[model samples]
Target: MEIPRRLPSQLPLILYLFFIILHTNVATTDTIKVGDWKEILNDTLVQDLGMYAVLRYNNSTGSNLSFYAVFEAQAQTVAGLNFRLALQALDADFPRLYKAYVWEKPWENFKNLTSFEPVLG
Candidate 1:
């Protein structure tokens, strides 16, 4: 089997477009904002979850909303004990599109955390 000679010609153009799109986040994309967490509601005697989060969705329709009460995990005697929660929606007043996500990890692993792109929007 031989590789298509034409495939190489399009490789550079493909990569260039990929990066350009990233630099300029096209419209219709939602952004996530993290809030402060305080007071653990679900205490396990080992880990206390603090709920102080809100997801704000900017709407082109001027019906923006915020989802209150997020998630936070704090632990002792553990090196990696943390997590994040986010709520995403296509628009403020629409019900056809929305998403919720959670990511957990240790404090030391934050450096290796994935970069932001699009979670639910």
Candidate 2:
């Protein structure tokens, strides 16, 4: 078998380009910054999480807040999933916007309502 001498010259550039691309992709996968929440396009599970958050808030605070609907939702993946949901609820027949943050580890069957506050806007 005859070995080609011209192969070595092209191999280095190819390998360098390959590694550059590989590094870029790996870096992109972890580019989730703090407060970089992506919108939940159509996840019913996320909507359900929003409802759970409101219920938990009501139970703990003894506020009679009825869940109306989920307006906007976003999720950030960390050690678990952090769901930030903007939801509409009724308090004494008044519709208001509320922001709820729920952190959950589904595999461990753990969920925590980190924050739930009325959006003052």
lDDT of 2 by residue, 1-121 (tens): 9877987899999999999999999988945666578877646786788789889999999999998888788889888889888899999999999989999899999999999999896
Write the residue-wise lDDT of candidate 1 on 1-121 in tens digits.
9866987889999999998897688553543224433233434421211111222223222444443322333222223333333323333554322222223344443312221123343
lDDT against the true structure, each candidate: 0.35, 0.87
TM-score of 1: 0.22
**RMSD of each candidate?**
17.4, 3.2
lDDT for residue 109 in candidate 2, whole number 0-100: 99
- Give the candidate number with the greatest lDDT: 2
Cα error of candidate 2 at position 9, Å: 2.0
